[model samples]
Target: MNASDRTPADLLRSALAADPARPLVTFYDDATGERVELSVATFANWVAKTANLLQGDLAAAPGDRLALLLPAHWQSAVWLLAASSVGVTVEVGGDPADADLVVSGPDTLEAARACSGERVALALRPLGGRFPQPPAGFADYAVEVPGQGDRFAPYAPVDPDAPALAVGGLELTGVQLVGRARADAAELGLAPGSRLLSGRAYDSWDGLSAGLFAPLVAGGSVVLCRNLGELSQEGLDKRVESERVTNTAV
Candidate 1:
């Protein structure tokens, strides 16, 4: 099958169809200081709604760029999928001015987008705590309103062969990523309903796809450390014990 024929959304959708009430992501953002989670069904709706909101709010044209400052993980996953579904390019900013649209993360959004200078037309950022105090000109992505549509339609049918990501200027195909994620899940031994503890950064491709998306799609549990970079062994131990998590091969 072609790359467009498969995607993380496919796996997520399957899981939601099987059981929408199940939690697809569980994590605490260090910047937000709030523990949040989204059940499979809620996540699906969130993705669709976000797609509609992004499309409407940004007026993103087909193949337009939406630079993502958010790291990879559960929350990032939904945004990535939503952006893809709506035909907006998901650009993880490695260099400033590399994107047409720029959205910054709690820690790095401001500096990251600063590289863009005046190149970026639309800047979407979350509000509240560390929501990057933009210097004069920038819009809050979180403030963007979700459109009236209850669902989203693909702006253009995504070809599995189309580049899903850019790494140092090289395009990575969507199908390749899906395959890699699946393979990693199998190698890690994750299956439906498995419990996982990750004190790792989801910014990396491997970590985001395998550590977060893989387990969630497989009907598993994901426990993320809010301070992943500073996570202590003791903290992970406590989380395991308190949560009654059973370790598996994955």
Candidate 2:
């Protein structure tokens, strides 16, 4: 695919077609002693299922705003790509009440309830297990998403010029997002096959770029660390060595 005509979804599709077996996201939660690795095909499967859930069940339309109230975990990454594939606008940490749908973690239960639209709650448990019981007003993501289709086709074509993401006071179209990510990947010295270890939170431009978009654009992968403060320098070093990380962003 030509770079000028590419979107984030296009990048992901290319990666899947090029090397479906390559590791796409490696997640670590130091506090919980959790480590999970998802290959490109596995990650794409999750994205497709979630995208189908959004489109088929939730009835999310292009340009619809989805409030993402979650941390920098693997599931959060899945939702990001799912929303992008369906041409939904992701508002990271946005006010749930104003969004067309809300996807939240246990920590944001209250805020998620305040949202009048459809709601999905992730347990964020190890292995992405289902919640003990469904959260009051929301569907359990683990319970619902798995039953959705494994392939996704948006109801309408995703416009490259449509708004795709809004975070940290920046609103970006699909093309702009991919272009910026490509530029940022070059600036960060990311090359194909690079593995980037990022302990930074996804609350700002720097963190999001390094932790997600840049890696996708550069045909690299990310080792995303949540609760990074819980790991000592020695632990971090060991993780970097074990994961064979080629770059670091914190």
Best by lDDT: 2
lDDT of model 1 at position 42: 74
lDDT tens per residue, model 2, 1-250: 2364456788889889889999999999988998899999999999999999999999999989999999899998898889989999999999998999999999999988878999999999999999998888899999998888888898899998999988899999998999899888998899899999999888776788888889988989999999999999998899889999999998
Candidate 1: residue pairs that collide: 3-160, 4-160, 97-116, 124-141, 125-141, 188-250, 193-219
Query: Which ten residues in a row are the worst by lDDT in model 1?
Result: 119-128
Against the unseen true structure, what C-alpha lDDT does each candidate score?
0.59, 0.90
* TM values, all candidates: 0.78, 0.98
Score candidate 1 by TM-score against the native: 0.78
List per-candidate RMSD values in Å: 4.2, 1.1
* Collision count for each candidate, in order: 7, 0
Q: Write the per-residue lDDT of candidate 1 for residues 1-250, one digit (tens) a residue.
A: 1223366556666776778887766665545455667777777887887677667665665566666666544556667777666656666655556665665655564665554432222221222222334334555444443333667776667666666665435455666666776676666677777766665555566556555655754567666655554545695567678755654321
Compared to the true structure, candidate 2 yields what TM-score? 0.98
RMSD of 2: 1.1
